[model samples]
Target: MLLIAGLQWIVGPLIEYASPSLHYKYYMYVEQTQYMGFVVPAFGIFVLFVLVLIKKTALFNFQLGRLENYSNYGLVIFIIGVFFDVFGGFLPGALGFVGFILSNFKFVGAIILYYSQSKKLKKIFYVAILYLLITSISKALFHDFILWSVFFYMFWSLKNKPSIPVILTTIIAGALLALTLQTVKSAFRAEVWNDYSGNKIELFIGLMIDSVLASDTDVSQIDGDGVDSNVRLNQGWIISATLDHIPSNQNYFNGATIKDAIFASILPRFLNPNKTKAGGQENFRKFTGLELSQGTSMGISIVGEAYGNFAHVGGILFMGIWGFFLGKVWLFLYNQIRKNILIIAFIPLIFLQVIKAETELVVVLNHLVKSLIVVFLFIWFAKKYLKWDFNK
Candidate 1:
């Protein structure tokens, strides 16, 4: 699913024809057609390397029963996480930074919620979903919804074992909901995100409700015209733009961002206070030639970053190396989880985006650093001081 999202040329038909009314936009593929010839073989090589990694690592032995004891604490942490994330501006620097770190690791709460709900913890399951709805609608869900949908699909498929008819119906419904929601979400973002004088929560709620209730009005706004080259916004465009631009621009960063990311990862901003910005926006602007406004990010996925530094051959090589690295990390976590190392739960939840989004390498690495720090601290406290149970 994630790989497909990064393949705009292929999915164009899914949006344009299969669901003609769906007016979502993507980067034009034809402009980068020549470069994309290289991309296909590289992607195929990527898949082969991934398959080799999978063959070397045995299937993850997930032990869901071990999660039962952590359910209540998970709920509390998730709620606190929501509060801290939403209202973090009111907190002092250190406290706010702490909240930011903890909030990012709250994916552990999500894993716990899945198990608790599967084991039939009604309040935890339902209430958490409600809170999630409110928070997700607050500006992030329009994009992050893909990550949660993975959880939702896996959870339901495991528990219910629904019939083919039922599965088909649900998928159709979900596809429509997703398409419509994005259409409506764009409007809600434009209208509600900037305004703060009015009751913000009420506005969000009203907008969500309005989007669903007034479906036609929401879907009508999206341009039904085919992909626009200049208006490229999503992951594929950034990646394609990088492949097309780097051959001549001499803008090759030559793995400088990765080195910076490694450095940034080693030093937390709180301790260093001088942690260099690893966002690589300047390099991305130079590569894409997009006149982005200040404080705005033009995200170049790991694919783009890899290409920017290494060209085609080096890009594919580094991407393969990255695949091996991330693959091993995840496999090790799975093994640890099987042994009931509860702290490892936080790590996976935190790294979920790296696995899903084609995020820039620096951003991905920074996420890794933050998650590892959060996981180590959580495990230490939960085991040494709180005496939380981890034994299977």
Candidate 2:
């Protein structure tokens, strides 16, 4: 959490702030000191959030249960998850939500399979590599690889408690991996996104191999629409820009948008036909009064949203409340893991996008609410029909 927050909010922005000329295309709307002024306090709120979340206190012990045919069930759920991923779009209307929910079984089922196996490291490595390749070739997205690896690591660390050196090495490797993928993905997409219908897996592999072999190529140099790693990671600019714009050129939303987010989370599109969309484009245009190109998308992040609704002091308080609420939710779910470790599998799904500071409140809340509903439904089905008490 700290690593992602620091990288996105502080380190990435600082890199851009210091080397403004390098990222001149992505200019900062506000002055250096002003950016720092808002950013420092914003980052402190994130630090407070983590502190609340990982607060070390004694947890109540609960009786553990052995799940019946747990590994087999896990494998079946994983296959189902893959099926949803391949053909989810074909589903119509609200049935699509079923596919979305079950799609997460990919992680949940993989976790079950990993825990059921005796050779934990070997199992996780193979699972992670397979997921990496599949997501890379099919979607050209690598966040899932990192997310699932970290998810698996959370489970491993519960028992293994890796040393400082090991933790540092993992962090460094993950960062380098993210940077490398970001660097190469633009080139990959450029070659494949156009009219190329050749084998994607082969194209991806060839691109990666070529990138590795080309020693003269500068990774920092922007290729067409590609953003450098620093700019890609830097979300502080949006906050800075929001602060500069709101209540100046346009009046404050005064909780109107926040209210929309709350309603959007609870009410489905079928019920509330005009509910705010997920892309954050509408909110960005409304809140920031800035027009983004059709291809471009950016959100006024949580911090920006807070300030937009309420000024400085109110924003700070909003952030604290938001952080505390999320921390408590985590604690509640974590406690249940003692009763049934299968519960841990859902944590990644719930907190998947919450960890991203770049996301808006609407996206976060919508995902959280729907994921919780799906999790409880799954659990209820297991207890009632399967005749398997999770607390057994």
Candidate 3:
């Protein structure tokens, strides 16, 4: 599970953040600072802390009962809520409000029905079909399906059973991968694999070292205005240029240089900076091109980020530690929340959103706190209603 999560996290960033152009021009320019190395380790440490807290709370105690009776209605409702949130965000005016209400109601209803043995699978199937229909028509289902597949796989793996359906699913996944690769190739008008020169392994290691070294620098000297100006200037230029012409995907080794530059030149000015008036939508419009929707972050990018900062061996070690600690934490949470419908529903929803969006800082943190509260509420309910002993 930890390996899977780590892989997921690494891939998205690599594809989106460390593509060839960014790597060569930005990453390479500041490679000496080893800025990424520091960030990755700090993230690992934070994950470690979460794991310890779960252990201390005695959260890991669970049993998977029969699937038929163990249905989670709350979870279904939460999933619906997410779908509504996405759909509503895309639509305009009153229609959006209708979508939001319908989705939220479906989600809330699903949760209420979870603990009851009232035709659960039928309801789930109907909701799934409705969701698929909406997603298909809107062309948003593909991303959601990809993200949900991971969660479904994890859930099924935990169940310790497999049949013909699993085999067919694997085959389908392979077909999808092939199709996606072909589509990306056609859209970009370039061979995807040809750009990856054999030097990625070495370059990734260099970037990791640079990231770590650069992270050590003190950032208290620079002012907030300077950082905002830098973000605007750099982000504006990149987005504007990419919109004008399709750049050659020649250099896949520039992420490290960019990381180094950010640490040395930009990090100092953003220590306690105020929020900048930047609009992502404006930037997105300016940078609109034949870019793949999935972006550049995937698989090897995570490994590359680690390698870019701490070098090959250090990257492996860092990821390994992160994986182990995260695995432990997740195990604990699963045990605690497995039978608690409310917590299970809310917690997984938040976690899914974080994983899907690659949310950072305040956003993810706020969700985490909300999830923790749900978990505690479940604990209190279990103690008062079911007579479960926390001290046991």
By lDDT, the best candidate is 2
Tell me the whole-model lDDT of each prediction, alpha carbons only. 0.59, 0.73, 0.39
Model 1 spans with C-alpha error above 4 angstroms: 1-32, 56-60, 72-83, 86-98, 104-107, 113-121, 139-141, 163-165, 194-218, 222-234, 270-280, 341-348
| The candidate that achieves the highest TM-score relative to the unseen native structure | 2
RMSD over all Cα atoms, model 3: 16.4
- Give the alpha carbon lDDT tens digit for every residue of 1-392 in model 2: 56776777778778887886355345567787877776677668856975767575245442212422366666666777778878888998766776787887876777666656456522743675577667766776666777777777776665457999999998898777666677778877776668678888887777666655656455434233546667888887777778788778778888888899999889888899888877788888776667888976677788789888887777777877887878787777876776676676678888887887788999988888888888878777877887755543
Q: Cα deviation of 149 in candidate 3 (Å)?
A: 3.2
The TM-score of candidate 2 is 0.88
Comparison by lDDT, 1 against 2, better one: 2
- Whose lDDT is higher: candidate 1's or candidate 3's? 1
**Candidate that beats the other on lDDT, 2 or 3, i.e. the better one:** 2
Candidate 1 has an lDDT of 0.59
User: lDDT, candidate 1, residue 202?
Assistant: 77
TM-score of 3: 0.43
Backbone clashes in each candidate structure, one number apiece?
A: 1, 0, 43
Query: Which lDDT tens digits does candidate 3 get at residues 1-392?
Result: 23334433333234334443343222222221232343345346545655664564454434333333434434544565677766767766424424534354343334334334567543653465356435532332244445444544444455546677986887587555533322322212222234644443343333334433433232211211112212211221232223122223222223442243234222222352432111122122222222323343211123333333344355556545544544565665666555553344344444643452222222332334444554466458657986654331
lDDT, model 2: 0.73
Give residue 147's error in model 3 in angstroms: 2.3
lDDT of 1 at 3: 57
What TM-score against the true fold does each predicted structure earn?
0.78, 0.88, 0.43
